[model samples]
Target: MDVVLASSPVDGDVGCWDLQTGAEQMRYRSCASAPHGLASVAGRFLASSQVGNSSSGSILYWSWHKPQVEIKSFPVEPIVSLVSDPDGSFLLGGGSSGNIYIWEIGSGKLLRKWQGHYLAVSCLLFLDNSLIASGSDDGCVRVWNLVSIFGERDNERMKDPFLFSFQEHALRITDIVSGFGSSNSILISSSEDRTCKVWSLSKGKQIRLITFPCIINAIALDPGEDVFYAGGRDGKIYLAALNATCPSNGKFDEYIITCLNEHSKAVTCLEITKDGLSLVSGSDDGTVRVWDIKSQRVIRVLKLRDGPVSNILLVQLPNSTSNLERVAKLPSLDKNLDPTGTLTAIRISPLNGPPDFGYCSSRLMLNAIKELKQRSSVGAMEMELDRLREEQRVCAQLLQRRKKLFDDLWRARIDTLLDDDQ
Candidate 1:
């Protein structure tokens, strides 16, 4: 897999590195200001934000294959973070001025602007195709229904439709992540207040809040969405299960958490691949470590010669037919299943080799297989449920026709008997 690492130096130049070879591939010095946030779409294009004395920041897009060419550059003001839509059609950027702008990815055209936050928006997450959650520095998180905003406009423009907002922290929200389990729409946000809060999108309320020893630097969810791993400035990583209950409005319960103090420096970035076998973490210690999530141990540590690893991205290696083959071998759904029913079985393949029963095996291939199984089971169940619903509708129509025919025949016999009596 190709890994792209971007870092913004204090000198106002953006440095791009190829993680696989540990080589500095390209450097762009457009804005004379320091960059703060970096975001990428499809691994082909990246957007880096410049934040310094310049009141207006700019986003620089670079070609992933040939990092020398500048694909596009657009100007934005007080930009805090940038995020691309799931399909990469639009790029959403939040600014310190409490304005969010959506731009066409390819053209860099301003599509719409969302204004709702009372303070600077720090983090943004696309909950689904038509919903976005934005957390502000004002300690409030707002959920926006993008469908309602777009549906009301005739010109395909988006207006602000703040579905709900919650003030759970006394400080800025640093990170936000959307989970991928049966409770799909759950969102977790980490703040400078040394706490992580879980919010339910369906209910539009805070469900749980987890406190930490120090400021939480980064947070990541397991592929199963059942567990959460949070890294803190205290150089420790904490693992907590989502099923554990906590103090809602008042009551305290079992919110057990396991802490691992392996890193000597603050963990800056954490990413889990689509196949949940391995997790990679980048830290301020200038090292990137790949961890076996099942064993909760670091397997490989890739040391860097330059500055600290600020970010780490895992891209699927091109021409890797094995990954595709593993995905194709997933099981099909049964004919009888509810479309909305939760998935029961998840087959996890090994990461380095073939499928195995042992946990934390070095086989990447096996881990991929297991991850594929989980995804396929859920998808197949949904498909089967849809098919069954259509069949049920057809059968109901046939039964209704048969009942009508029987009623008509009985009525005809009664009329004939009455006529004979007369």
Candidate 2:
């Protein structure tokens, strides 16, 4: 099921709704989330970074059907952004102190930590399974290759740690979104400078600088990469041309193909549905609006009625996720980085490869266990256990006999040595 989630800084609940039916789901409560800090952890659970004034901030996790937080971890520094890879094996937290921390989600072990930006990290996006793009308050957007960062040896020297760094925006970054390509995808970043810059990952250069009428707080790319929707502080969502070229008229108004003017306040976040037919946006007006892409009209409006919506996410949850299943199989997030700890989580391959992650394999194992429980009886299981114990006893007896034989052979050799010496 495809669901859209909205979070607010002042609100205690994270609002969730069905994208297809526009029906409200279970509202995950007690979450005052930071902007760009809400994420669906590979459909297993929901996680959000809390808005806190303290030096240390916390990240909370809630089961899909639960309203209360099930797990919480305080990081070394306040994290402003949180994201997980599609495989759900690794969770990345961008700290307020410009450091990015990667944790193994299965074991909750901190795998790596490095300074990713000059200022507070604003947003983190996965370009592919192996590449991640981070935007910061320093107005710099950098792409990091996870293969080199995580897989490379400490003694080995990387030619350049960052794959690409685009420092075109003059103000703090508010949001970052990527287009359909893997490593060669086009990255779009919205900033407080009233501009949205598009960078080419393959080319490693700024391709387009779009000047908006207002500071674009959020951006959502069209599935085809033909155009991108930019939500401005002026309460308008501007559809800017991506493939089509407009004659370089110096006016910023020329870049806008059309605009959605229903939002009464600054649009805080934007997300396009999986089918690319609907555009969902959250705003300061405490409403989440879903717009039909073809008609460019609001089809559904979900009233949050709490505070300004800070983040929005659209994710596909598995149908098998039972509401009755309370405890999540995943581990809790670790409070601090453990250098001596080992990451027992099964590592995943690149996005293009076949499935080998723990979550995917775990589902299969769970299904097998359910099937076994249904087919086997208690008496049959006990009989099987007794048979296994008998086999173990036989092996133990054989080992003892072999040890006695070896000891006897050694004594015979020692006696022969004594006779030869006499």
* Cα lDDT for residue 33, candidate 1: 25
lDDT of 1: 0.60
Q: What would the TM-scores of all predictions be?
A: 0.65, 0.79
Task: Give the runs in model 1 whose Cα sits over 4 Å from its true position.
Answer: 2-36, 152-160, 181-184, 245-256, 303-309, 317-422
**Residues 1-422 of candidate 2: C-alpha lDDT, one tens digit per residue:** 88889999985789888988989988898888888899987777888988676677788989887788888887878889999998676889998988888888867878777888879999999976777999999999998877668654441234458877888889999999998765657899999999998887655668888888889999999888889999999999999998776665565556678788998999999999767899999999999999999999998999885888998989887666543253355566776656554445443234474433343233453455556667886755654564466569756855664564355446656755776799
- lDDT (tens digit, per residue) of candidate 1 on 1-422: 55545353233334544444545555545422221266665443555655666566556564444434254344546567777766555667787887876664433345566575778887777765556788888888877755445434432234436766778788988778887421236888888898889887555568787777688767888878888888777777777678865444332224535666678898776777677777677677767777777798987676655556555556533333332332222222121212222222222345476433211222443455556567887755654564466469756855664564355446556655776799
The CA lDDT of each predicted structure is 0.60, 0.80
Clashes per candidate, residues 3 or more apart or on different chains: 17, 0
Q: Which stretches of candidate 2 lie over 4 Å from their true place?
A: 152-160, 247-251, 322-329, 340-342, 347-422
Q: How much is 397 displaced in model 1, in angstroms?
A: 28
